[model samples]
Target: MIADRARQAAAAAALVGCLLAAHGTAAADAAAGARLSAARCASCHSSTETIHSTVPLLEGQPKAYFIAQWRAFRERKRTAPVMVNLAGELSEKDVADLAEHYAALAPPPAALASGSDTGRALADRLRCAACHGSALRGTHAGAARLAGQKVQYTTWSLQLMRSGTRSHGTAAKPDPLLADLSNAEIESLAAHLASLR
Candidate 1:
């Protein structure tokens, strides 16, 4: 009986040690995430700055969504040639760290200055609401929220669509509305869409 009890005690102690080690590892990951964000992502994506005509703020995004994008970039499923190279350099742990860092950030302000009524009308006509939802919060699966997205990212994505470069499974054709739009219209739409909180 004494020998059996000793074995049980050892097992319990091992379990406790494992639990503590797991907690410590999680804390370390969060710290690493913060550091990585400052080093790699702060230039184009701000956590706390006001929403401007260009950069996109990446705070408070869903962790799964954020990680999925990084994975897609890494896998070349989402083809931003520049992003592909950048994301290729990250390991799974680095991706998790960056996602956690952005997920913990505060979202930026929502004040866009779109200069064209035509672009807004076109967006509405194109049924951008179908997949992106009424407020562009994005569908739960596969779709990304466009509200408060970076203007540069949005415009660049649209340009890619126009060029037959960026191909998402959910998106069918090049955004027909965007295809007909002039450069100015695209810019106005990007700025206005990014302004939505």
Candidate 2:
């Protein structure tokens, strides 16, 4: 009984320490984040408003996800040239600050594209629902939420998969059905998926 109580006490202390660290991190300077956003990310990406169709609206993304992506970019695991260059200069604290800033911003409206019958049929046949869920909200096992994502990013990711430039893993290979889709078809699907949110 005494050992169990001691372990519980230790766990409570650790949880308190974690909470304090999180609070301290959240209190980091917003001005520094604004400066970093302008200097490092504003050129190709928009931090304040949604103007570009190709670039994703980083605003309102989960801070944890944003931080993870930034770390991936910095490590070259993400393989995006723009992100690689931007993330390379950011320290861990800068990444946390930037994630906080972006997470606090509002998400932009989603643009829905009318899907061609062929594209819709293709999507249905390919069982996109299996991984993306009925609402495309993503699953916990690496499937990303397709809903509310930028259409350009969605299409580009599909194109990458089709061209074998990007593959999730051996267990999650690119669906062969997508390989033959025309650019217009891809765009239509992307727009349809984006409309979910």
Candidate 3:
């Protein structure tokens, strides 16, 4: 299983490289994405910066990553209950517009626990920037933007991924990194990410 994940990660890494070349450095247009979001996703993804624990913050995510996720949802490869049906209804333009809208918004700020020094080091060592970009923001590779994500949500999600109990999408490959963490490590990591500006 570990070998399989390594292979998957390698493939994903290559895909990310290709996407970077293709996308250059273009970020999405917030105005267009916002209009689409208001029309299509305002109910769950409230206009306010506050995000519920179950839902992820979409703002400031990379357009390419957001598009990729929507496509995955549409194809039934990824599995967010709320997203599965909705994704199928979105037109390609809607996907692009929404991506830009979320990407334009800033991540909401949150406080973190002190004394998580080791966790901070671990995050840096993970080289999350390799895919998520230097700012821990989503990049052209379709990585989810992690800066200022809710700590509880991030922690819960990580726990699920590690335990193989939570599924992001049906076809979503498990993150191999999550498989090796202890509970403390996960919490620390979550705290570190949530504290990002």
Candidate 4:
């Protein structure tokens, strides 16, 4: 099972790299992105950490992943009324700038693990590092950072991914890894990920 997942991740990583290259490679202005974030994104997305459990912490997120998410919102491929409205107002440059700025910021502090041994075991069994990196801090492949992420948000995201309502690549396709997960397993994984420093 793990070997199959590793192969899948390798294939996905190559695809993502190709997609990013096709997307574009231009210099972004982080300063401009900082200004835009202060004016437009600071309300819900705090620079320090996630404002709510449901809101994701954007600080120190991978640049490629950030850009992709913003693009998804802008194109309505990922639908959230607020995000779509805000992202729709941004130009491609603005999206790149924001990705640069947020990627350079400090990540949120780690949450207390309490009893996360079980979760850690689960993560190991699932081979989360196949795509999320050994530290689960994301990768150049455009996978979102999972280390120290908000547990509620992670759980919600996993559930959405499982149901094909949200996806890393396409909304129409659900992640096979998450397809058979129960709510308990999802929560355990989220809790474990949230505890990573």
Candidate 5:
């Protein structure tokens, strides 16, 4: 319990620091971002399909949040190997442009799968809506939309967050409650959320 609290506190601090950084970043052009994405990001993040179950669907993510995540990846604060290299390849303008491109897209459909019934209740208890919006479509404040995220990606992401390997940018703390979740429980939760519009 203490460890979970500590992790949450650390995450909260990081969120503040990141939100501050986001305010001063420059704007980007979606067209320019699209061109760059085609070259560097398309293979893994292609909205047409899930290349891997763990890769996130980037469409309609909040632009500022998207920029902040790329910046974090570029700066070595985040821990995705492919994203770090891709983010490093981008110039500041490219980062902004790419964020713009992804942000302008409509949320694509994800492959939904079967799971237990507890996920929705767990999400309610977690108050996911406090940050992800009532409908989970994301906000300018940094939450990514979860409604159409791949079930595998969502389950993996929740596990990472619970295990302290990933975070919801810098705004909120990792949920200590998730530490008690079994793998099947996490999958059920992910499945339910993915079923939302």
Candidate 6:
């Protein structure tokens, strides 16, 4: 219980920091962002049918969260070959526009939960809601929306975080909550998260 509370406190602190950092942003132009996305991001991110299993769905993400991630990729604080290169090309206004565009779109629908009850229990114990909102739909705290996310993407991301290959750029720390979980447990947690709408 104490450990869980500690984690929640940490998450809350991170949220506050992000909120402060994202303050004073200019209004974004979603229309311009749409055009830019169509021109540049369509090949991978726009196509629901052709997108890889590991590609996260960005629609309906919080604008602050989206902007933070885009900047991370652009600054090379978070590393993905294509995203680093692509995000590098975007201006600050371009990122804000894209954030607005994607944030306004509807998120993906929920999928069936294939995991057992244990997954739900694990999420409850972990208090994922502390960071992800009551519905796991995300928060203005710079946390990504998790509801109805692709299972494969969630699973892979957890594994990367656990293995220390992925981390929050600002925090620079892998989630300790994920460190001790087994592969099967991570998959179960991902399934539970994917099932929420």
TM-score of candidate 3 against the unseen true structure: 0.71
Off by over 4 Å in 4: 1-26, 47-51, 110-115, 170-172
Error in Å for residue 185 of model 1: 3.0
- lDDT by residue (1-197, candidate 6, tens digit) is 99999999999999998898788566789999899888887556644453567888887788888888888898888888999998888889898898889888865664455656978988898788888789887788788888777778888998888777888433445768777889999899999888777
Task: Evaluate all candidate structures by whole-model CA lDDT and list the values in order.
Answer: 0.69, 0.69, 0.74, 0.82, 0.79, 0.80
Better of 1 and 5 by lDDT: 5
Give one digit per residue, the lDDT tens place, for model 4 in 64-159: 999888888988988889999988888889988998898888666655544377789889988888888999888887988888777888889989
Off by over 4 Å in 1: 1-31, 47-56, 78-82, 110-116, 173-177
lDDT of 5: 0.79
The top-ranked prediction according to lDDT is: 4
- What does candidate 3's lDDT look like per residue over 1-197, in tens digits? 99999999999999999999787744445677677788778666543334566576676777877888788798887688779999988777678778777777787556443427876887887777776778787667667887777776788888887667655433244656667778888888888887776
Select the stronger candidate by lDDT from 4 and 6: 4
| TM, every model | 0.64, 0.62, 0.71, 0.78, 0.77, 0.78
**Candidate 5 on 1-197: residue-level lDDT in tens?**
99999999999999999988888666678888888888877777765455566787787778777878888898898878988997888788887788789888866655555444598887888788888889987888777887777788898888888887776555344657677888988888899877776
**Cα lDDT of model 1 by residue, 1-197, tens digit:** 99999999999999999999886535327678888888887766774344443445667665667778888888888775867998998877887787778666655665444435765775687677787778776554546667777777778777777665765445556745456777777777777777666
lDDT-better candidate, 1 vs 3: 3
Error of 3 at 185 (Å): 1.4
- Candidate 6, run of 10 with poorest lDDT: 42-51
Better of 1 and 6 by TM-score: 6
Give the poorly placed runs of model 3, Cα more than 4 Å off. Answer: 1-30, 46-51, 111-115, 164-174
